[model samples]
Target chain A: MQLLRSYQLLVTWQALRKKAYLPLMMAVQTLFSLGIVLGYPLLFPTLDRTTIYLIATGAPAISMITVGLVALPQTVGEQKTEGSLAYMRSLPVPRLSYLVADLTVWLGIVIPGVVLGVLVGAWRFGLDLQVSPLVVPAMLMVALTATCVGYALASTLPYMLTVIITQAIVVFVFMFSPLTFLPSKLPAWLETIHSILPIQAMGEVTRGTIAPNEFGLPPGAFLVLAVWCVLGFGVTYAAMTRRG
Target chain B: MLLQIEELTKVYRTGTRANDRISLAVGEGEVFGLLGHNGAGKTTLVNQVVGLLRPTSGTIRIDGRDMIADPGLARRLCSFQAQAQVPIDGLTPRQAIDLLGQLRGSSKLEVRRRRERLVDALDLGEWLDIDAARLSGGVKRLVAFAMAAVSPGRVVMLDEPTNDVDPVRRRLLWRQVRTLADHGAAVLLVTHNVIEAERSVDRLAILDQGRVIAEGTSAELKGRLGAALRLELVLSSDSADAPISPFPGSSVSVGNRLMVGIPMDGAGQAVTWAESLQRAGAIEEFTLGPATLEDVYVALVGGVETGPAELEEARSATAA
Candidate 1:
């Protein structure tokens, strides 16, 4: 009963706290997603059907991933620097309730962007999307893993370092990861690194679900994402629950 | 005692001792003040009580339950206003207060009533709907106080509650603090403001260098200065550096101001000496009043260096 009440309170508290900037945040996310979908094609004179499918499906994945990895961390870092995080910790609410509430809010913020990205991608490319039944669960798992990791980073590191690390992550995700492209195009060493990291798994699961006919589902991707999701929650829980 | 602390000690990993073997208790209907200068361990002690920080070695009891063993219970029993103002950039005073009250498990109607009372009491009506980011620091502080006081538990711990507040609102805030205690809550107030604490707290402990140097009712502490009167002189520019201890008392000098302790029997002589100094253009003005808790504080905090020999010499000189 206490857990349920705390969860309800935290959701309302977090939603109100974000009410002012949520619209602006969503607009930015939409723009970023639209930019990838609309602008990336301008870089190429002619795109093949396979290329179109990859870019169209990859836009939504990037949008969801960015919300969790980039936007969530920045917000948490600001809260940490402002001492609001410590203030919240001092409350009598259950720690897990706070974490779940935060994840729920960030998920809400990203959903519109993810949907818009997928819609705009299909319309722009005039491509066929074989959306699988697993799409919703796959998107949720990717977002949960990324956001929990971001939360853990912000909770454990100093604010300035978290900011810097998040920025570095943005560059790595956009430039190095195979989210928007084929893994075979990258060097073997880079692919090997991506195999161990969660970013590739996030993109692979997302791509498999959104374009199942074009890409096969890899059993290892789900296992990798689940491992990261649990690890992130564990680290974040430890950080929040530790005394002094 | 509603809130009891025994030998509470907190030492940071950096090896700095923030609190040292401090022990104190507050009864259910008491407004107890923890008075000290900056870095004197007052806020540190409050943080431990509220479970934001852990004490290295100590026992905290709220209503006979060991709080250190169960910090969740500590948090449930103690509602705290942190030293830093809560970040509510996008929130209004009303929303912030109401949300916190609900978060603390108050009913919606109860939250509304408490919010209205706090807004009226703090004179926050004009700024109730304004964005807190646009409000002044004092208003934000008032909002933070309201948030904590809205659904106060068995104990309410406030740290530097009056720091940036205006004089009028400070009095109102004090009234609310007392009201909290009157409703059967133990109030633990931490601050560096001596005069306000003396006026507001039923009992207080003065901390220095992480240790409690003195503790008692305001009158009891002031009585330590035993019939000593405080003679304050506004020295003229020309006499700013003059060593003007014509009477028997310990004196502390700060730029253009001098405070001297005089025996009550020497009140007339002290006044006459002040008049003489004024006539000679050594001082611009002077006032003589009974020593206050501030005097006892300064003496004990080593501001006047009241050593045994100096105290004996002052006594003999006053007698002669």
Candidate 2:
């Protein structure tokens, strides 16, 4: 526990000390999220209940996705290339504890943007947000799962390959995945996969919290996110602890 | 013993043996140097000992704990400075050192004390507040060393710690290395700087092709060359010779430099012969000294210090 605390302090200080990169990355995340919220409204000018729910909930989910799929992996890959990863590995700190610390910093950076997105969507589109009690917990789950998956990819793959994979994920998440749209719009095959994938589940959980009953929030969505969380953490831990 | 490696062997997936049946032990307060040329398996051996690489066959014990079975103990007991300059990103030297110390389980006060000492010792006062990335390579190397020394564990492994350092800072670095050993830490220094090794190492092992060719104190190893000395004579020209084997041994010519190996008994004859050559304008400048770690390394590793031609000349001289 002490080691974890030290890692938390170390990671926080490390991120805070990066005078330029931290703020730049955070700005990109916030603006990207705001862009999604504002741009989607333009596409659906005729206000409807479904569009409003999608904009508010989907905006937050997009922030999580951007952080998880882009910013986190890039930072990790840069560290790996620069030998900081080896420095971290040489320390006596627990491997999982380092991951927890890293997740905390990243989640801290992205959560503000998530809250802002929710607020902007509610204010701009007049979303009658029910704001379920589970919103914070659901948001935490989304952030954790996304960060873990990114960490797993960053730690396990070569830097160049990780970059390529991250780019691919960005394209898939924004253009193909049904995170912001109805599942009926996706082809049967892709929707079948998204049913089990965490992206759509993240949107469903977030949407269910704010617009409960209007959009189906199957208990199974929470189950899917939980399973993904377990899988991500499991793979990341195994990768970090694996012997030569 | 603070650290021990028994019959350690590492065979990569490509079937290249990096360390072959290597065995050694370092006691507390001992600074053991590992000397080798590039691809001599020095780094491989250190990596295995630090738990960064898994040996195919061997047992590594750190503070008497099995490293492979208990890597956590190894991590806690070893502080390593890798060959590459530590990438500090944007953290100042002070922050980096403190963070590493705390991560290594040092107390706040202890970390602060050590950080101050290191910063002072390494002359980091000017660069202490500057970000590591903006610092010069030599400064970065010093900061990395400081990070390693902040809270040294029972075993400290430093790989090429003085690579980019200046001569003045290099001296200070050597003192810090000795200080670590004096504090009862087992220091493993892997470097190609045999000259520095003579001053800093209590004992050393010279590795070649994944095997230890020689291991002993500086005196003991040089003793193997027994009254044998190295003569580095820069010839005025590579022309007419004046009894090339002046002292009854081979004298090989490497470019304009002719290196001759001589025994104590043959010193007079060799000096006389070189003087005659000098008079004849065949020799320009010359130096004679006791055999160095470089000489022993060249003799054992073969052609490491000198080129292929020099090795051939030395081989024929010995044979003759």
Candidate 3:
């Protein structure tokens, strides 16, 4: 009964709190995803089919990552500054329920953009995408892991620091990470970092699921995502439940 | 007692003691006030009771259940209105109140019923559907109060609940607070408003520098002042400091205001002296009234005094 009440409270409160901005956020995500899919090709004179597939599948992953890492942290930081986070903490609900509810809301927000980005990517590139059945679970896992990591960051750090870190993560994901290109092309040390970090794993899983014939599923990718997901949740739980 | 706090102490890592061995109790159906100035640990004590801050030492028990061992139970049993305003930017007052009521485990219908009652009681009918972000600060404060009162648990803790409320609605809000206590919940009101606390609380504890200096009902606390009357002087200018007392009593001066406690028999003398000071252009106005909790507060808190040079200069200027 306690669990049910906690879930109810968190889900409803979170959803309502973001109600005015959800549509705008979804539109922004969709526009951002579309920009990546259609605009990236302008940089390269001629793209190979594999490169096109990578960019196509990469757009959705980046969208999920942006929402999770960039948007979620900013929202949570605002809540912190506004004292709403403390108000929520004072509620009788279970602490973990807050994380679940936030994840659920963010996932709902990211799905429209992901689906549209995938369709638009396939249409623009004229590719017969061999979308695997595991795509749903792959995308959900990527979204969840990104959001949990962001939630943990927002919960633990001061609001201004959280905002700064989130902006830095955006730059890292866009410029340094292997989301839009092959990991082998990067330097060895950075490649190793991507191998351990969840960003590359997120891209790999989504790209592999979307174009099964084009790329083989790395055995370690799912494992990496699972580990990061757990770690993120553990940190977030500790931060939320700790009395200070 | 529904809420019992014994020697509750909270020391931050900066080595600042926000609460120093504070002990108090509030029984069911009572409005207990923790009255203190800013940084006097009133909000700190409330935060600990709601389990938002863990106390460094001592114990807090809600209905004899140990809160230190299980802070979750502390949160579950107490509904708190924090000193900071609750952010409800997108939500309307009705939505915020209803959601909070449901969050506290009330059924939908029950929550709706209680929300309606609070809306009427707090005169929040017009602001019910307006976005809270657009509401006036006082209206938003009323919304926050309704949110807490809608599903007040075994204990309700309001930290400076009347901060931004207007005079007319503040009366309404106080009535609602009384109604909450009358419903058998222990209401712990934390505020520095001496006048409101005196009238609203069944019992109150005056805290200064993290210590409870006095605790009692309004009449009981005021009884300590005997038959003294308070002589208030509003100085003519900010630079004008309080003159040395002509009578045998204590006085507290803050800014351009001065409050001196004089015996009841000295009221006529106090008025004559105040008139003289007014004619000397040292004071803009003066009032003499029965000693209030404010006088007791000044006597206990020993408020800051202007420098001797400043007082002497103002006195010499008045004489000249």
Candidate 4:
């Protein structure tokens, strides 16, 4: 509960939203739903709409991962710049508890971005996200895993350079990850690499839930995701707790 | 003891000792001044007292609770208003005060009743809805102090409380501080502003390089330096130079206004000198006065002296 309403996180969220990052991403999401979603079926009348629906439902997996990798670092970097990090430590709460609140707030924000992406995919592509309700928890697990991975990278990098590296990684992983197209479309070696990447797990999980037959992810994606979550948590927690 | 420090020592990582075996105690109803130069461990001492930093080897107790063993309990008894503004940029002034009070365990009714007076006194009606980042520097400072005083912890440690405040409001702030102390809160003020120190603090501890060089009333500290007399002189007019030569060794000029200094006295000579200056018309409008905190501050630390007049000069210089 303390982690939910921390002063720094609230202020940081306001600052981030005002930066036009969230609004701009949201705008793109709305367009994706309205244009490619409805316009695609209208433009290609001969194309089968079920597969198109499947593609639309899963297409945003890559974009969500891209935004997550790039935008999440701004959260931690803003805290450092605002001087509230030191002030927060000055309070009576245990250092770890305060940091946990920061992590929780950033993780919370990712939910909206991911959900918006998925919702637009559903509404525009004309395919129902036909996964079991159980997939909601499974999808959350993938988001949590991606969150930790992004947090680790952000915390370890310097504030000025955080944006650059995060943007680069977002682009790098979005290009190669197997969630967008079929895994068999990739060369066999690249297919192995995609299984372990943070974004790849989310992509695979979303595609598997939405269209399990054509875009089946390997069973080991979950194992790779768990490993990423644990390692990311360890690295980021160490970075936040290091002595000022 | 409202506050206690025993052999408080804070040594920086590079081996320079910021605080060196300092110890002091302030009972309730006391406004204690911690005076020091920029690197004189004033803030380091304040930080430990407020639990922002731990003593390298010493212990701090607030309201008799060991600060380290149960820090949350200790925090209940004390609040720290730091020199740097604690940035609560998105919060409006009214919300900021209420939030601070709530965080410190004040009841909703208590916060509701207390916040109105604070809002009015701080003249924050205009800023009550504006976020802190949008307010001016002085306004943010007022908010910080108001937040520290919302519940009036048993001990409130203020580091340079008057920074970014105008002179008219500084007096108002000191009055508020006195009211808090009179109500039984132990107030610790850390500052380099000797004028503010002279006029406000009931007791002062001059800290030199992390050690208490002297601790007493302003009069006691000045009296120790040597024989001193309070010299007072009225201005001939708003603009005439009030002869200040007769009062030797110290002077403070508030404006084209009164000048006074308690000169060092060895067997009452400072008095005789004041009379002599009176006779010579150097101080045509003259009376002997008491020594001040500025005098004590200069004697303890080697530097060019500052009185209200010099401060006036410095202010004009910056303006020019």
Candidate 5:
């Protein structure tokens, strides 16, 4: 594990050496999150308290989801196409260290977006009155789960196909998913579908912190999210450990 | 033996037998060359030795440790310089060397010492700080070579190490390889460059289509031609149709040139025959020299005159 952490630190340093890209990406994430949370309220000024509360908390969840489902997969796929993945495989380090280090760097990049989105939402909407202790842990789980799923997708598919699939996923999450809006707004049958998807469960947990009384998630939400986390990590591990 | 491989075979799922039953051994402080044309299974054999691919059969023992049972031992014992350069996009040459060395379990002090030595030897001082992506292909290959050599290992496998290197730098690279061997590391050099193999390898194996055709020291392989000397000639346009043999052995055509082996007894007649052909305007150019490693390679892998019956018939006809 010490060797794993050392390798993680080394990889992180090499990856983040160009400081220009990190801040630029952070700015994009912050603005994109702000756009969904603060922009939606401007378009629907007459929305009631619960709908506004859902958007405020769901905005951060969206930021995490986008990073995981789109950015992570795209970056991983690029590494594969560039032969960096093969180079890493040639190293003498432990096989599991690659995953642990890669996830660490990406998670580091993603978790801040969740924080910025949550803080920006609270500042933009003056409605947050209480904060739960579960917010940090919940957000971390969501980001990790999403990133793992993206990594699995990147490994399972070729680069071009991964790119197209990740793009479709980003578009669906941004436009069609009930992440930033109430599930009641969707048709009755569609609501049944989101109940099982990890995205809705993620949003509920994220929202629970901002509006504990009104939008708090039940224990079943965490359980469903945990199941997704286990499945996602299992796939990513299998992909990393696969030998040619 | 520093590295011993026995009956290694790799049968791909597509039914392509990349590496047939092959065996080889390399001792400490020896530079062993694997010579072959493309798709001759040199890389496949190297990959299995390095633990990148599992052998369908046989055993690879490095320093008396079985690599199959403990793949990590292969990593610990051998460092490989692959044919394709490792992608070093964002990192500089120095960082790449340092990172790989450290990842290979070199301490920081050891890494720094090796890095300084390798950078100096490879003449990469100017480009060490530049982004590797911006460097030339040859420079990247040199950096990759440095990365492979920086760590401590008993065996070093260099696959086509001189592909993109300039002549001067290539000489320097061979010097480093020799120095590494002098320091008691067993080096496996996989290349198709016959000239480099002749110059650098202490002993070598010529692989053709996943099988070893010949294995010996350069002098020994060259000596396979016995007392025969090669007499090469470029025939004039008018004389091209007529066979030009100073002393009849089988002549092999390479482009418009005809190369024939002369018995040591017939070698004295070569200069007289060349003079006669020159005066008659039948020959444009000619040279007579002892058979070289290339000659042996041509005879073996090129399949021009490898048969015992053809050799005996050619000798008897020449004697007649």
Candidate 6:
């Protein structure tokens, strides 16, 4: 077996056993996102359920990605400083495995995010969340891809810098993506920006399927995300392989 | 080979050399002590052995498996008790042991069997139910040691095994190390406390600035000194803290261990020191053992230059 997968699994196990708070935070975030979606029905009762579904799906998936990119790094950074990283390295387990394990656990953390997005969209829009047999397979793809990206980011720079940059970029994109008239109707540069951001891909794909036609997602969004998965994985792989 | 490290060199990216061209071997049933002062590359070498830090160039073979090339196989063969505290604040010591055992692929029955015995031997009974973060630094070090012993592996590498431990427990820790070697696990001990090494180590290596300057058995190393002993004495009371002629010699307290030097040249003086201690009821034990590994260390590493007057000072302080 490749050590990378072993590392990912080990990191996942460590988080489950030692850092249980990570998952609890994920649960809370997902619940809050769901609350936002559910509350929309009462506040904007005039709008049709389909439109409400679109907003709910895009909003929470974006939030989950943002939390994962930002919060995860600070925790990992603290561990590195306290010498836990050195302690684990002293074990027989490969250093790469430790990195992988951390990323894998982060992927598991986002499950609550997905559930919130799905449930909110379903209830508000009256759409079919009746567990598409496809959900599992799609989610599995999204998971491995997200981990490849997250772990890659986690290892590339020092933890604090990664967390800061990740939060700034994630929040900026989330708040501004909807306002970028290009994603719905404008310029080449802005469209290019929308084309590659993982949140945008998530919003487009999720919205395209659940409420239908809100983000004006073209087939290009899937292709862009696929490129990201491949490139994110390559970058992470290259970065970790280069480290001592 | 229990352990065969060949041409192990670690040069950090910043051009600092931590470990430079080191080679070593340890056979089963032997306790090998690696001595070095702080920042002397002792921890660096040990860390590489356990796969904590990758070496710039070299091969580490434990039980005939290359640790760098096949780390998982290496991990399976070795148990590392590091100097740093293990983070298992979420679990009790018992649960921590169980979790580590499971991680090592031990059966539940196997874990239970080993834990029951080690819990008492390491004096972990008092802290079994407590969270690791709540453990005192000494207790946490013991906990780390216990975890190393909790699972059975072919090679055991312990960094500073007796640091912060009481003398009574230090004795127990050395006995446990000897027992581990006796049970056929090659033991690697990294320590700066030469006095402890005097009584315990089977063979030793003195490391200086990432280099192994001297390596040999304690007796072989000490034999180079011809005839001299590192002696230390302790008085029974507070008034005894005042320096006086116990045996007309000198001694110093190195943490809990009293340090003194005895010269064979003054046969009458040595006798007087022993007799005075026995007479005053100040001496708990007046032993004339052969020169220890510490003497060998001072002789070879620091160069032997202790004087008769210093010895007298030590004797009086310990006797007083």
Report the lDDT of model 5 for residue A32.
83
lDDT of 3 at A30: 77
Docking class of predicted structure 1: acceptable
Which ranges in model 4 have alpha carbons more than 4 Å from their true place? A1-70, A92-97, A119-128, A146-171, A174-197, A210-214, A217-220, A223-244, B49-52, B69-72, B208-211, B227-290, B303-320
Cα deviation of B23, candidate 4, in Å: 2.3
* Candidate 6 - chain A - TM: 0.74
Candidate 4's docking class is incorrect
Model 1 chain B — which ten-residue stretch has the worst lDDT? B311-320
Task: Assess each prediction's global lDDT (C-alpha) against the native.
Answer: 0.84, 0.79, 0.84, 0.66, 0.78, 0.65
Tell me which residue pairs clash in candidate 1: none
Q: For each candidate, what TM-score against the reference? A: 0.93, 0.88, 0.93, 0.73, 0.84, 0.75
Clashes of each: 0, 0, 0, 11, 0, 22
Q: How displaced is residue A230 in candidate 1, in Å?
A: 1.0
| DockQ of predicted model 6 | 0.20
Candidate 3 Cα outliers beyond 4 Å, as residue runs: B225-227, B237-241, B279-282, B302-320
The C-alpha interface RMSD of every prediction is 13.6, 11.5, 12.5, 9.4, 14.3, 12.1
lDDT of 5 by residue, B25-119 (tens): 99999999998877778877887776666788999998898998776567668888877667676788888888878777878799989999988
Q: Candidate 5, clashing residue pairs?
A: none
On DockQ, the candidate that comes out on top is: 3
Second chain alone, TM-score for each candidate: 0.90, 0.90, 0.88, 0.78, 0.89, 0.76
Per-residue lDDT of model 3, residues B1-320, tens digit only: 98999998887655667788999999999999988777787877887788777899999999999998888888889989987888777888988898888888898999999899888988889999988878988888889999899999999999889988999999999999999999999999998789888889999999877888899998888777664688899988843457788877778786788888888788888999999998898899998888888888878876653323223222221220
For model 6, residues B1-320, the per-residue Cα lDDT tens digits are: 58988888887655667677888889999889988766667777776776655789988998777788765566668888876677777667887777666556677799888887777787779889987767777777777787787775888889898888887777877888888899998998989899888677888888766777788887776656555665555544532552344443344444333545566775567657767765776655555555677655654555233323223222221220
Angstrom error at residue A194, model 6: 3.7
Candidate fnat values, all: 0.44, 0.36, 0.63, 0.12, 0.21, 0.32
DockQ of 2: 0.25
Per-residue accuracy of model 4 over A1-244 as CA lDDT, tens digit each: 4434445444453343333444666675455444545554565547564447445754556545554566666666555554455455555434565555555555555556556766777665555555655466666667677667777776676666777777677556545555544567798888777665666677667777655544555677777778888898888777654432
Worst 10 residues of 4 chain A by lDDT: A13-22
Clashes of 5: 0
lDDT of 3 by residue, A157-208 (tens): 8777888888999899887888778999899999998889999999999899
